[model samples]
Target: MTSIAAVTLEVADVAAAERFYSAAFGLGSQVRLRASEAATTGFRGFSLSLTVANPATVDSFAASALAAGATSLKPVTKSFWGYGGTVQAPDGTIWKLATSEKKDTGAATREIGEIVLLLGVDDVKASKKFYVEQGLTVGKSFGGKYVEFATAGPSPVKLALYKRPALAKDVGVPVDGSGSHRLVLTGTDAPFTDPDGFTWESASSLTPAP
Candidate 1:
């Protein structure tokens, strides 16, 4: 089965991006940085989701990200889904810190539970089918609206799909965007680009699995 080994982010400055990631979220090796001059604008068609234990942890991560030079897209707010917020990193990547739990289980900590790479696509069904063809197992599905893929990669980053417009709204961004996605997925499968133009390459081992 196909599994993502690393999430490589194409940035203008790899060193600066490295610093921001370390200082902001301390994501470890889940994210990789590569220098690129690819032209990109607007939403970039994806977001990195950071799931925490409670509202307090979400707040802490948000505060840390902002302090590390991430631009605030949406401040932390509670919703029916959970408590969360959106922030844009200095490297132009969007991050959503969220938690399904509404209440704080205990004192807030710097621990992060899961990381899901949410790719905004034009068609969920088509994309889902394409991924299945590539050997990714379907972990969850909700018709044409969303799909989550189960993975067995060494570096564990889960994968999920959502409509472009809907995903943009969830991340608090405008739908209009063009040019390079500025993102790449390194996985165990042979190199190929998905229907939405996300490139997946074969890698030995990496973080953020699916």
Candidate 2:
């Protein structure tokens, strides 16, 4: 089955982007997969991997992004809610940093909450059919325009189908092109919405499986 893989970006310098992210978020290091000799590395985390460009052996376009504006938004620091960092890339894109550790709730069971993913679609029925055939079971159907899907059993992943215009109205954003959004959920692939049409997915709050 086809799944969303990586969200790529273009950057100017690998080292500069690395330092920019590390200094801003206090992240660790990573080496390139194919280009061991080339100047490339990525960050960790499901949301990590700030790709930098190679001057001599440039591979992807992300290397070009470092030249945009890449500025520091929030310096590396910890907070009551969680550890945090923030940066604005050269392209004027904002990136936030938070503690990767799962918080302890001081209870016998794990807690559960909602984590939503927004996906772009040209036809809701077509997309829904595709996902259903892939073993993603439908939980609730919101008329012909919207459908909710769950993994299986007491699944952690929840999929919501939303029309592009409806979603834009809900968020109070003008129905323009889709910008960028992050859906932080465990045991699921990252879902990205298209420029205008989008998909909405959610995750149940973590809870004890019993």
Candidate 3:
């Protein structure tokens, strides 16, 4: 199955954004940074989720992000599902660090299990259909509420869809926004835009701007 090969975040300062990412998440090449000044306000309509091993790991990441200059939108807390938190990076990207495991089983490491790209779409069913036509198979679907795409290949990022308002609530932000999402995904083959206006480009073309 096709997976998102990489995600590119367009930021105003490539140098600062790169440094922040290195210190905050150390995402390496799984995320690429590019230079862009596209006008954006309110919520950006998406979030990058980091799924870790346990609650301790979540706390560790949350601390690391704050120490690296990210503003905390939600403190690490335990919910019925698990423990998690939300932070907004200096570049204006919302990142959710979470784990389904409520307790720690071992020492906390910077080991990230999966990086999920959560796109907040206007229409879940429509966006799901658009991605399906783009050759992505559905791994999980929750009616028109949400959807997840399978990733059996080398792609590192898991893709999912959620209602925009719900996602914004999860991030503790308003759903209203304008201009670019400042995000770009490297999909399986050709480049195209989804029904929600998220762009997917060829992997070879996803390198950081020079």
Candidate with the greatest lDDT versus the true structure:
3
The Cα error of candidate 1 at residue 33, in Å, is 0.6
Give the per-residue Cα lDDT of candidate 2 at 45.
13
Summarize candidate 3's per-residue lDDT along 11-117 as a digit string, tens digits: 99999988888888887788888899899998989999999998888988899899999999999999998999999999999999999998889878888999999
Could you estimate the TM-score for every candidate? Answer: 0.94, 0.35, 0.95
- The TM-score that candidate 1 achieves is 0.94
RMSD of 3: 1.8
lDDT of 1: 0.88
Q: Each candidate: what lDDT? A: 0.88, 0.37, 0.89
**By summed lDDT, which 10 consecutive residues of candidate 2 come out lowest?**
52-61
Per-residue lDDT of candidate 1, residues 133-192 (tens digit): 888899999999999998774655899999999999998999999999999888754678
Which residue segments of model 2 deviate by more than 4 Å?
A: 1-112, 153-156, 178-210
Error of 1 at 147 (Å): 0.1
lDDT of 3 at 199: 85
